[model samples]
Target: MSEAALPSRPASSLATPLLILGAVLALAPFTSAAVALLGGAAIALVFGNPFQGQTRTWTHRLLPLAVVGLGAGMDLRTVARAGLHGIGITAMSLAVVILLGLWLARVLKVDRDAGLLIAVGTAICGGSAIAAVAPVMRARAHQVSVALATVFLLNAVALILFPPIGHYFHLGQSPFGLWAALAIHDTSSVVGAGLAYGKQALEVATTVKLARALWIVPVTMGIGMIHARNNKEVAADAPPVKKPWFIAGFLAMAALVTWVPALHGAGHLVALAANRALVLTLFLIGAGLSREAIRTVGIRPFLQGLILWLIVASLGLTLVKTGILTVG
Candidate 1:
């Protein structure tokens, strides 16, 4: 008989995963992902990681699906126009951050791997950037962990801090969204802060940040090329590079919403579902942040990440306020 026709499994067999899922769903309505993630992590910290095996499934499978689902709510043309308007400043911000981060890293006496990881994470998309370039740079496992911890801690802080700062300055939706997209380290934090400000800000922030994330490809590959040129040999232990293919899916869903006649009527529903999925994704992401992981983040790397992010945030806002960077 097929599994569908078979009897249900014993409750003991499904308990942990079910509990975790239930918690996520139960908390999804009232709280933002930022809060949900913290709550999930706090629960895990107290009770131990109940969903250890499933953490991989959430990060690799579910998170990308959620991001793609988000595209269904977006108007691709508007996202594209906003992307074009912001691309120049985005690229410039990345370049300045990386150069300045590396220099500051030297001044701070941090080593090469930590410096590069922090620089890329600041210049591009936080943990994802660190993960992407770590293997290419032949970074040690400890180095990767420390860098990730630094970024994750700062990401949580940014989610809390950026929204109020934006409001305090009385920023318009477009400007606040652009500032969040440019200044925040991770996609979740950017979107969370944007959502806190307003719906229009959320849309603009998500689009611009995802567009900035596309730099992962060139950034990692370029680092690989530079390493090979300087060392004259490729590391045998280097991990295979994976492209951010989900970005294409995100863009495709946006196009489908913009162009497909049959799907047009359901756009609102689709977008709503996507937002819920993103929140669920964030909750799972939070549960993955363990206490042990947080403890391992050294003071030096953390300081490096903190300084770099503050500079990016301050510089981007200054440009925005001065009318040097136009908001869409």
Candidate 2:
């Protein structure tokens, strides 16, 4: 069954190498961020779009594994610590990010949804949040993909610069978790920062990040309702996706740790592995974005992203210090 022996294959085959590259990249320190920042260099050197084609399509399957594994880290107790504050924390964080983002975009005179795309991308899970919101808001493919690249570029920058900044201030886990949850743009960088400091920190940091993730539900629902009323969206785009069952699985994973207690050892390890895998998924998404398309989004999108990012960074600490939010 040697592939070389088969009838000459199409030039369109890249499935094997991309997966292997993703796995290998996961092991490198801040690999996700490094790949994202430098992935373009690889792409340029190769003179091909590894970001596209059959290999890229298959990468989506690996995504669920990483997300579900992330669930293994969260638990009932983590949620309990934040309480109504969980929703408030996410709400407060999102509110600040969106408001500030809009202001920057207005100043820059960028497109509205494009600005919001930057807001969500920077505020939540970077591209994942932007992708989630894009359909709900009915943003154009150009704007949305551009937003993704904008977020990816900043993510790489954060990886290079934030860790040293976190160190410079002598931040510890509780504060560090808040800094990460609010400040860092994606779970990969947050986890990288949290883990580099210590595993215990990553556990708390991831939980905080998950609490932030809870914002996606209400945020999407609110945006969907508004768009539906506005008639801005095409009929085909807004079809309801029953909240994925994995959310239940995520909640269940968290509960198993809190209530069962017996699963802690195994659960902890699984969660840690999941955090690592999630990092790879982010880079994979980053790689899929085209270089020119990425640049078309431009420096303004990043400025908008940065505005939201800085607000979160500041307010995250304020809320944590003032006792508005607390963590395990």
Instruction: Evaluate model 2: give its lDDT.
Output: 0.63
Model 2 poorest ten-residue lDDT run = 1-10
Q: Would you list the C-alpha lDDT of every candidate in the order shown?
A: 0.75, 0.63
lDDT of 2 by residue, 1-328 (tens): 2111223222224533654565567656566445543553354324445435443564455555655676666667665564445565466657767777888889988778888888777777765577677788877666765676677666666666755666777766666666676777765666556655565566667667656666677777788788778887453433233243444566677788777778888887987677666656555554554546545667777677766676677776666656666664
Model 2 lDDT at residue 205: 70
Query: Who wins the TM-score comparison?
Result: 1
- Could you tell me the lDDT of residue 213 within candidate 2? 64
lDDT (10s digit) by residue, model 1, range 1-328: 2112323322244446644664567346666766766766665565556565486466667667767877888889977887677566667767888998898888888877778898999888887788788877877666777787788888888887888888889888988888898888877778777877888888888898888898898889888888767674434443455566777998999999899968976876766776777676666666666666766676777888889888888988998777777656
Clashes in predicted model 2: 1
Q: What is the lDDT of residue 225 in candidate 2?
A: 88
